[model samples]
Target: MHLENLITQKVKEAVEAIYDISLQSVELQPTRKEFEGDITVVVFPMLKLLKGNPAAIGNAVGEYLEREVKEVVAFNTIKGFLNLVISDTYYLNFFNGIRTDQSYGYVSGGQNEAIMVEYSSPNTNKPLHLGHIRNNLLGYSVAEILKAAGKKVYKTQIINDRGIHICKSMLAWKRFGKGETPESSGLKGDKLVGNYYVAFDRAYKDEMLELKSRGMSEEEAAREAPILKEAQELLRRWEAADPQVVALWNMMNGWVYDGFETTYKNLGVDFDRLYYESNTYLLGKDVVAEGLEKGIFYKKEDGSVWIDLTDEGLDEKIVLRSDGTAVYMTQDIGTAIQRVKDYPDITGMVYTVGNEQDYHFKVLFLILKKLGYSWAENLYHLSYGMVDLPSGKMKSREGTVVDADDLMEEMSETAGSIAAELGKLEGYTEAEKKELYHMIGMGALKYYILKVDPKKRILFNPEESVDFQGNTGPFIQYTYARIQSILRKADFDFNTNVLAEEIEGLQDKEKQLLKDLEAFPQLIQAAAAQYSPALIANYTYDLVKDFNSFYQQVPILAEPDTRLRNFRTQLSKKVGEVIASAVGLLGIQVPERM
Candidate 1:
């Protein structure tokens, strides 16, 4: 059992034995630095039941716990707070128990229910941008954290492959290109397609300008743009399954898919299942019809289907058009149902979308609940804020967005420059240097984005993220590498457990590290529960800070005593391992050497 659980039990027993009254629960927190204790118990809550002065009650409980519990060696009372000093033996025992655990902080085989996490559902018309990067990193890290916390997870994405936006790229490519392909153009397929999307926008704007100059209103010019009409017509033909249109759609979408796979590989994110808008666009019509029959949805005189949710604090939303066409909401509803059907074991789903679509997800989840699905209550919207750069906001159609591939390359270049300046790659060959640069670059990118809460927007600065000091990924990676260096230098075996008697007394630094290590498993559970990788990222940072302080203050390789040296080395190794584990959950990699 955990130390908290043991202490809580003892505290309840102490209260019942002393006051002859059963305490409902105990409130425990980390002991303040000035307070000389491992954990502090608040006696104020028990005051309501015990009927006495807070300090007196605290002292009584503290004395009783010190007398009754083996782990509690001493105690101090500061008003309502009862701080108990835990024995070094208890921490040593706990350390020995977890030292050999390869996955020390992770819970194994606990929750049986599976969760599906959906993210990076990019449109096929363009290459992924910085926004998509955040979506992928957040979803992937959250899924990994959930898995570490013992819940089975399936990562998924719904690719928006068929829409007017896709048609715009296809139409522009066909109209402007004189038989250009990704092969002949020497460009990635997604980038090639993305260029045409921008071209289409440019052409559409020019046409609208011409129409407006020819005496049409702004709205009329926008509605009458020739390129817009062409794209809409292409969409209609594709929907009708016209052979030419279908062939073009297939060819273009296939190129985009191939490009996306390469990007996903580079980004280190993968999906267990892939959903396409093409197949699912018409899926919810039948469900909407059924809902209308059941009075869960209503049909207007013009034949549009709607669901009134005004009483639920939301406006009425349309599910199907008068022409019997499904809207985005209807398609999402059907896609969700289809996912559950596809994965029957899925007990919950997390939709990793931007905050812009917060209202959409709320409506979708609520509609599913009204439809009487048991799993609807388990749906989650992992809505995150937009990612901006120092240069300002990105616009895809204007060809101004920060392309993900370009950003990654820039990060690698920045890391390489920083490494060169630091002169840490003296023995590394060219190829090894390149690989290290990429790892550090990607690590910095992922960590920087993930360290912030998902609901907060980011103004990312690439140079700042790669700095080798102060809460950055490279700093933590450097500390990990330093630990590896220490382990390599220690000739004697430090893997064996250090017996409690062999180590004499624990230093303040070592005890602090042990306490931080003890918090790891609980931290994992908390991060998983909150669905926040920021918790994991910041916790790792704090742990690294603790380890660094210990390293500076305590001598491991230079210690004269064999037992003390071995124990310190073992503690360092465990800290390194925990750091690796924590950062891994954030989708950041650690280097064995800096």
Candidate 2:
């Protein structure tokens, strides 16, 4: 049992024996660093039964603990807090048990309901950008974390493959291109398609300006733009399954899909299953009709179906349009039901969308519950804030968004420059150096984004994130590499099976390091419970900080005492293993040597 648990149990027994009161539970907190203790038992909560001065009660409990519990060697009462100093043997025992177990913090996955995590649901018209990066990283990391916490997880994404936006790109390419293809242009399919998306926006604006010049109002001109009319016509034809239109839609979507695959691979995110809007767009239409027949939904005079959510504090939301066409909400509802049908074991789903859709998800989940799905209550919106650069917000249609590929390339370049200035890469081949630079860059990007609360907007700065100081990814990576170097130089046979016993006079630094290491398993559980990678990220930073302190104060290889040296080396190796595992949970790689 953990020290706190043991103490809480013993303290309960003590209260029953002394005050003749059966206390069910006790409040415990980490002792203040300024104080001399490992855990503190609060005395204020006991007044309900004991009815005595808080400090006196604290002293009595402290005396009882020191006398009865062998691990509790000393105690000090600060106001109502009773701080109890634990013996080094307890920490030593924990380190010895977990030292060789590289998978110390992770639990095995078995006999648990699988969870579906949906992220990176990008439109087919354009390439992924900065916002998509954040979504992918958060979703990927959360899936990995849930897996580590012993849950079966399925990572997936819905491809928005059909819409007016997609048609805009298709129409633009058809209008301006003389049979250009990705192979002919030597451009990524997604990028090529994205160029047309931008072109469509530009041409549409010019057409609007011309209409306004002919005495049309701004709104009238926008509504009657000839290019938009063409795009809408293309969408209608594609939906009607016209042979030529469907073929064009399939070909262009194929190009975008190919491009999207490359980006996902480069960003190191993957999906177990893929859902496309083309197939699922009409799914919820029938459900909406069923709702109307059942009076779960109301139909307007124009034949639109909507749910009145004003009573639920949200405005009315349309599920089906006036022309009997499915809206985005309709497709979303259908897609959600389709997932459960696809994976019968998925007990819950986590939608990794932006905070802008917070109300949308709330309404969706409520509607699903009203429709009487048991799993509706299991829905969660992993709502994250936007990722903004110092320059400003991005607009995809204007060709002003921060492309994911460009940002990744820039990160590697930044890492390369910083590494060269520090002279960190020596006697490395060109290929090896290039790979290291990418690893460092990706690590920097992922860590900087994951370390912050998902709800708080980030003002991302590449240079700051790549720095080798503070709570950055490279810093933790460097420390892990440093420990690996120590392990490589150690000549002793520090097999974990025959590790050191409770040595005489263990240093405070070493004990603290052990205490920190013991918290890893608990930290993983807490991070999973909160669905926040920030918890794991910051916990790792603290572990690295503690190890650094231990490294600086204690002599490992140079220690003449063989037993102590073995213990320290084993400790360092375990710390490195944990650091690698923790970062891996964030989908990050750590180099063995730096």
Candidate 3:
């Protein structure tokens, strides 16, 4: 049982015996640093039922607790707070119980119905960028955290493969390419395709400028640009299933898919399932028809379908155009329903998208509920803020966005440079050093992004994230490595449990470490419930800091007493295991050696 629960029961017993009044609940918090106690019980709430001075009431409760509870060895009353000092034997016994349990903080799955997480739904026209990195990391980490908290999860993404943006790349390639392919051009397929997307934008702009100079209005020039017309025509032909256009669409999209696979692998994110816009774009039309008959949605005079949500504080949103073509919202509705069909076990879903789509998801969920889907209530929009570089915001159409692959490579190089300067790779081979560099680099990148609350914007600095001190990822990874070093140097087997009576007393740092360790299980549940990886990330940092302080002050292998040394070694190992487990939830890998 948790110490808080044990103390709460004792406090209730104390209050009943001393005040002759039955208490409902007790409020407890970690004692302030200046207060010399492990936990503090707030006594002010009891004043509501029992009329007395707060300090006198606290003293009465403290006296009863110290006399009756074995764990409460000493107590101090500071006005309205009763701070209780717990026994060293209790913490040592707690440590012994969990020292060998590898899955100490993780709960088993199947505690509730499954959830589907959707993220990284990128367009096929361009490679993933910095924004996609955050989405993938957040989605992947949230899925991992939920699993650790005992929920079955399915990772998924919807590829935007069919759209006007895609047609822009296709038309440009057809018009300007002298039969250039990825292999011939010696560029990644996505990059090759992305270059043409920029080419299309540039050409379209030049044509619009020329028409404007020739006395055409800006709007007329934009609507009549030859390149724009060609791209629009290409979209129409592909949608109509024109053989040649469809074949070209398949070939180019296939190239982009291959390129995306490489990037996803390097970024260390994976999906259990994939959905394509091409297949799901027309899916919600039948559902919309049913909704019309049921009066859930109304058709406008121009033959467009819409749902008026003005009563719900939102404007009318169109589901289908006058020409009977489904919009993005319609596609999303169909995709969500289809996902439920694909996996009936899923009782909820989390959509990891940028904050720009906050309104879109609100409408989507409300519409689903209005359409009588019970699962709609469990839907959540895991909206996150954008990641900005030192330079500024990115635009994909102009080819200015930071490519995910290049940024990852840059991170590896930066990590390698810092590692060399620190001279920590002395005995490591070139290949080993290279692998470690990537590990540290990726760990730094993931930790920096995940440590912030999802809704908070991040100004990412690669150099700062790789620093070996402070609240950075490499700082936590280095401490984990130090713990590994202590384990490696301990000559005897430290896995055997230490008898409770063998250790005389707990040092302040050691007690602090144990207390931090005790919070891990509950923290996992809290993080999962809140859908905040920042909780786990910051908790691990605090645990690591405690362990580091303990390491510096206490002797492990150098201790003269065998039992005490063994206990310290066991404590260090457990801390390392937890650090690995917690960091793994954030999709980071820790090295055994710095």
TM-scores for all predictions: 0.98, 0.95, 0.96
Worst 10 residues of 1 by lDDT: 494-503
lDDT of each candidate versus the true structure: 0.93, 0.90, 0.92
| Model 2 residue 3 CA deviation in Å | 3.7
Write the residue-wise lDDT of candidate 3 on 318-424 in tens digits: 99999998998998999899999999889999999999999999999999999999999999999999999998987888889899999999999999999899999
Model 3 residue 131 lDDT score = 96
Badly placed stretches (over 4 Å) of model 2 are 11-26, 42-52, 290-295, 300-302, 496-502
1-594: candidate 1 lDDT, tens digit per residue: 899999999999999999999988999998998889989999988878989898898899888998889999999999999999999999999999998899998888845989999999999999999999999999999999999999999999999999899999999999997778899999889999999999999999999999999999999999999999999999999988999999998998888998999899888999999999889998888889889889999999999999999999999999999998899999999999999999898999999999999999999999999999999999999999999999899999999989999999999999999999999998898999999999899999999999999999999999999999987888889999999999999999877778997777899999999999999999999998899999999999998998999999999999998888889999999999999999999877888888
TM-score of 2: 0.95
Q: What is the full ranking by TM-score, best candidate first?
A: 1, 3, 2
lDDT of 3: 0.92
Which digits, one per residue and each the tens of the lDDT, describe model 2 over residues 295-409?
8899889888899988888889999889888887888889999999998888889999999999889989988988888888888899999999999998888999999999999
Pull out the clashing pairs in model 2. Answer: none
